[model samples]
Target chain A: EPEVTQTPSHQVTQMGQEVILRCVPISNHLYFYWYRQILGQKVEFLVSFYNNEISEKSEIFDDQFSVERPDGSNFTLKIRSTKLEDSAMYFCASSQTTEAFFGQGTRLTVV
Target chain B: AQSVTQLDSHVSVSEGTPVLLRCNYSSSYSPSLFWYVQHPNKGLQLLLKYTSAATLVKGINGFEAEFKKSETSFHLTKPSAHMSDAAEYFCVVINSGGSNYKLTFGKGTLLTVNP
Candidate 1:
């Protein structure tokens, strides 16, 4: 079973520093997404990407957040300046059709 | 808009007992509902999904969910529980015909299976 894979299972960054979370979605999938879960909060959608551009984004996806499909296989989320609140488990997902497949997730910690 | 509500934050059951995790959904369009399980320190794993085709959806690990449109509910159930079934379960909803394609997840229900 092909699965979406994320890089750097865990990351620690200083507040105000940049962090890039990488993900390699299943090769044939057309849609990609980024979501995050705070320690005691629900998993919230950040953004969705298709056709190499952002299709939609939630209110939580502010200017500090950006997503890119740099290549055919790599999808990356870049946070220009991290804040303490940005520390959470960030998940990468992809879907060819209805069902979205999720990656193991990258735990981002900002101190 | 799409949203999911998991009724119980935590549920306890003994091994071999039945399990029920309640879920309710609200959607502006036709919905695709799913149940995902996340073991501690593990990624979210899809258990089952209910699209327009079937109301009773069966998934891995002997889990199944029935979609009740009139009730706006898609509840997960299992005939028997096992120790391995202890985990955090999330009920998710997505707008089937919408262009965004982002999933809205519930707070999650933590199932505790005791010996």
Candidate 2:
């Protein structure tokens, strides 16, 4: 079956550096989302994108976080000046309707 | 707003025993509920989902869930547990009435299948 794919299964970055986590959603899906799970914490929604624009975002999604669908297939999440708390497993998901399919996830580690 | 509450943070069951993971949901509109499983070092996999279709929804791996509107609950159950079934399970909810289908996940229930 076609599944969402994320790049760089794991990443390590400096505390103040920027990191871009990339995802290629299922080709025909229209909605995309980013969510993160801190160690031993609930998976929290960051933002949702549709029509190449942010449809909604959570409080955790601030100025430091941005999402872009730069191309037809690539959806990327950029974090400017990553913080230690930014370390987590970030998941990319896409859905044509109510049921969304998730990617393997990118483990971002900021030291 | 929608939220999912997984009653147990952890559950231990012996192999071949029945498995039950409890979940409750709160939503303003009618809700679409889902159960997802995450094995270590793997991505989240959809086990099953309950849209407004049948109250009893069956999923992969011999798992099933019943959507009880009166109780506002969608709990996952299996006839028998296997070692491979040991994983973190999340109950998820999304508003069925809205266009933006942002999934809200529960804290997760860690299932440990003992031999």
Ten residues in a row with the worst lDDT in model 2 chain B?
Answer: B94-103
- Candidate 2 on A22-49: residue-level lDDT in tens? 9999999999999999999999999998
For residues B1-115, what per-residue lDDT tens digits would candidate 2 score against the true structure?
Answer: 7899999999999999999999999987778999999999999999999889999999999999999999999999999999999999999998533446999999999999999
Candidate 1 lDDT over residue span A32-77, tens digit each = 9999999978898999988878888989999999999988999999
Worst 10 residues of 2 chain A by lDDT: A48-57
TM-score of model 1 vs. true structure = 0.97
Instruction: Give the TM-scores of the predictions, in the order they appear.
Output: 0.97, 0.98
Classified by CAPRI criteria, candidate 1 counts as high
Model 2 stretches astray by more than 4 angstroms: B96-99
lDDT of 2 at A98: 89
Judge candidate 1 at residue B40 and give its lDDT: 92
